[model samples]
Target: MLMPHPKDMRTLLSRYATARLAHAERQTLKSATQLDDVSYTLCVATATTEINDALAAADRILAQPPPAASSRP
Candidate 1:
């Protein structure tokens, strides 16, 4: 798949983080058993790491200038 622009990726990552937090909140409300709590915790941990990775990648991409186009036809 084609890579997304860093600015766009950052926006999308923010949305993803919001959605994940909402899901975690819903999961928390429904968690009545130990297994359910464990599952919710794992889900939250995974989401946190993935979101952090995406944010870091976007930051790295934004820190550099875009590559120059080749002059040759």
Candidate 2:
């Protein structure tokens, strides 16, 4: 199997983080009528936690060296 380079992984992770943040904002907006100020703040905080976790995982993956290519006959 082919492995992605660290730079590529980082780019993908960054994009994912952006998407998550946008989604969170959209959700907050959509549910604004149902949420009070404190609730909205909590929702954003939860979303941020999720985003941070994903970024941390991605960083860990990117830190590892790419697998060595196999030699073929």
Candidate 3:
């Protein structure tokens, strides 16, 4: 399986975490009756797709060779 670079993985994870926090906050702000029942479902679907894409990209990166080191002394 392909692996993501460390930096890329961190960034992708951060974005997903931020989005998750935002969704939670929004849910907390609304009263039970005021919240849309489908909002959580939609958010989960969107975030799942984005996270999966990131994972796939990371995997692709893993399949590539590492960069060559410089020969300069």
lDDT (0 to 1) per candidate = 0.50, 0.49, 0.46
> Quick one: best lDDT, which candidate?
1
Name the regions of candidate 3 deviating beyond 4 angstroms: 28-73
Pairs that collide in candidate 3 are none
lDDT per residue (tens digit) for residues 1-73 in model 3: 3333444444554555555666667756443323332333333433433545544555555566654555222
What residue pairs are clashing in model 1? none
Q: Which segments of candidate 1 are over 4 A away from where they belong?
A: 28-53, 66-73
Give the clash count for each candidate. Answer: 0, 0, 0
TM-score of 1: 0.40
| lDDT (Cα, tens digit) per residue for candidate 1, span 1-73 | 3345555555555555655566666755433343344434333433433535545655666676754555222
Clashes of 1: 0
Q: Candidate 1 at residue 44, lDDT? A: 47
Arranged by lDDT, best first: 1, 2, 3
Order the numbered candidates by TM-score, best leading.
2, 1, 3
Q: Write the per-residue lDDT of candidate 2 for residues 1-73, one digit (tens) a residue.
A: 3444555556565555555565567766634433333333332433433545545555666778665555321
Q: Per-residue error at 38 for model 3, in Å? A: 18
Q: RMSD for each model, in Å, please?
A: 9.2, 10.2, 9.8
What's model 3's lDDT at 29?
A: 45
Local error of candidate 1 at 69, Å?
14
